[model samples]
Target: MHAPPSPLEAERSDGGSGSVRIGVLVPLTRPGWVEAGHHLLAGIELAGREVNDTGGIAGRPLELVVRDTAADPRKAAAAVDELARLGVAALAGEYHSVVARAAAARADALGLPFLCSSAVLDALTEQPTEWVARLSPPQSRGWRVYADFLLGAGHSRIAVAAQPSIYWASGTRVVRDHLAPRGGTVIELDMNALTPAAVCDALVDHRATALLLLVGHPEPAVSIVKAVRRDQRLAEVMMGAPAGQPEFAAWATSLGDDGAGIPFLRYLPERLGPLGARVERALRERLAGAPSFVAFEGYDTITVLADVLRSHGTDRARTAESWPRVAVQGSRGRIEFSRTPGISVWQWTGTPVHVVDRDPAEPGRFRILHAG
Candidate 1:
């Protein structure tokens, strides 16, 4: 693969004409969280439209060259290659951590600037690189907060219904490491071998007071929740999904009240500020329903990228260099990027973190249990 064009070459490549195109990587198809993709895309598209409506980047239209990753790392890497070849000024939008990692690696290798929209994995790149930056809080930070929530809720004996994946593994490790020092024990129930009934049985055997769903939605996650809720032996066991699976509507549609009261991590404040409230209204109309934190993350990604592109121009190298200087107001808060310890990308440390769950009395309403 050819290395990305230098600032001068990139400036000339566009011929100082036409739309300012950004390569958008999102999972819009199956095997990829489709609902999450829809919300993400909605936020991105809304922001892109707003940018163009307000004169766009330096009087040129802002266009998004979208590619569906389908939650596959290989597919994401290929998409990065294709987008780079297509001469996109920068890359944006991805919801899955593993897939985003693959894209970030490829973008770094080819010297393309990638403003990751979601994907909270701490090590986005093998080593630090200016080519990549992220909007989501890292798994370590989010899961550590989750562990604290577990401990504060008086559930020291925790069990994780985990699948085999790097993202899940990292989350499990973060929770384990955080809880270990505080006298909390985390039992890993491998989903590969255990059925939903078997998971409940393991909870009973382990005497775990809380069972976290480290698996995917609708299949093992939904099934495990149903099984645990139905099994009288595990009725008192608190259920959780630290990865924010329950933030989407599909979780409620699939499990209803069974899905309610299951706390999960969310990257949103308890109340939306002025900007957040305005974006929330727009996104709700665009989505025809309540928007998840993923949607806000998507909006913020475009918001930040648009700011950079406007101030720094669309040169790939220049865009990457401008990460640390970024200071744009997003729906969530004052968005800024800085080098966070152990994180390889320019991270927005100010992103709000909340532990929330759907109210059992009203499944549509969310209740914030904790904030960090």
Candidate 2:
């Protein structure tokens, strides 16, 4: 979401008068990042359409050079270097914070002003390279929303179940800080691997009235939900991150009523403005009907980078100047950057938390239980 990804690319005007080559490192193999990459490419192509229709960057057609990292940090780092070796004027990369960080560090070392799609981990911004920027808010943002929502809803005690991984760990910290001032105490459950029942047991042991599931994938989350629902824990409500992706609903269709009213933190708003509309339409055409987080992330990442070229910096000196000023309106509501550590926003600025209960037999989905 950040307009200029310090972790992504730096540009050099081609000797020829009118062309620029941009490099993109995609999470082409991993299921989540792969979906993210596809939508991102689709978003770029759509932007490419607009640029071609007018003129091109500096008058020459813009060329997009892409590579697949398969979600591996080392591979992503290598791919970024390779793209730089091949000589791209600008660059953009995947949404995973760890992978994006590796890529960003390399870009910074090379003096490449890399653009990251959505990683928001605080470490990414810690070194202050000025080359990297993120568009997503941090876990603090999400925790703020959830804590406010919880206090407003009148829940006195809450427990958050999150992975010990750096990304989720950050989210947990945010949740705790927000809940402390109020009469609420957030118990952290660190688990190597857990089944649905184990999750329920943790929640039960803590005697939590609510649970915030902060994770980057949907499978473990799906398992947790099943156990909760199977046991019929009627007192608790569940909220989670968009990291579960829309596909999570498909996989957990069996949860029926329990999955009903799960909240998902979505990036794209329903009504996209002019530019946002075009990106949305292109994404729908490309995605068919898959309402995954990848589509929004992809659209936002590419659009932000393209906007940086058009409205902000194309050269490093200009980039440093323009990055702070650039903002892109796309499928993701006002895609931009945040000073965080991961390529994700839900970990920071809290998600809207949608319930995931969608009936497989029916085409529609379970309604939103709560907005925040």
**Each prediction's TM-score against the native?**
0.95, 0.78
Model 2 lDDT tens row, 212-305: 6665444576676666666666355554443444343344444545555555444444344676566666667766754454455555655666
Once fitted onto the true fold, the runs of candidate 2 whose alpha carbons sit more than 4 angstroms away are 1-19, 216-218, 242-258, 290-294, 310-314, 327-372
Each candidate's number of clashing pairs is 0, 50
For residue 301, what is the lDDT in candidate 1?
A: 89
Residue 249, candidate 1: C-alpha displacement in angstroms: 0.8
Alpha carbon lDDT of residue 55, candidate 2?
Answer: 68
Q: lDDT of model 1 at residue 7?
A: 30
Each candidate: what lDDT?
A: 0.90, 0.58
CA lDDT for candidate 2: 0.58
Who wins the lDDT comparison? 1
lDDT of 1 by residue, 1-372 (tens): 222332323433346458788888889888999999989988888888788779889988777778889999999999999989988999999999999999999999999999999899998999999899999999999999999999999999999999999999999999999999999999999999999999988999999999999998889898899899999998789999999999999999999899999999999987889999999999999899999999999999889999999999989999999999999999999999999999999999998999999999999999999998
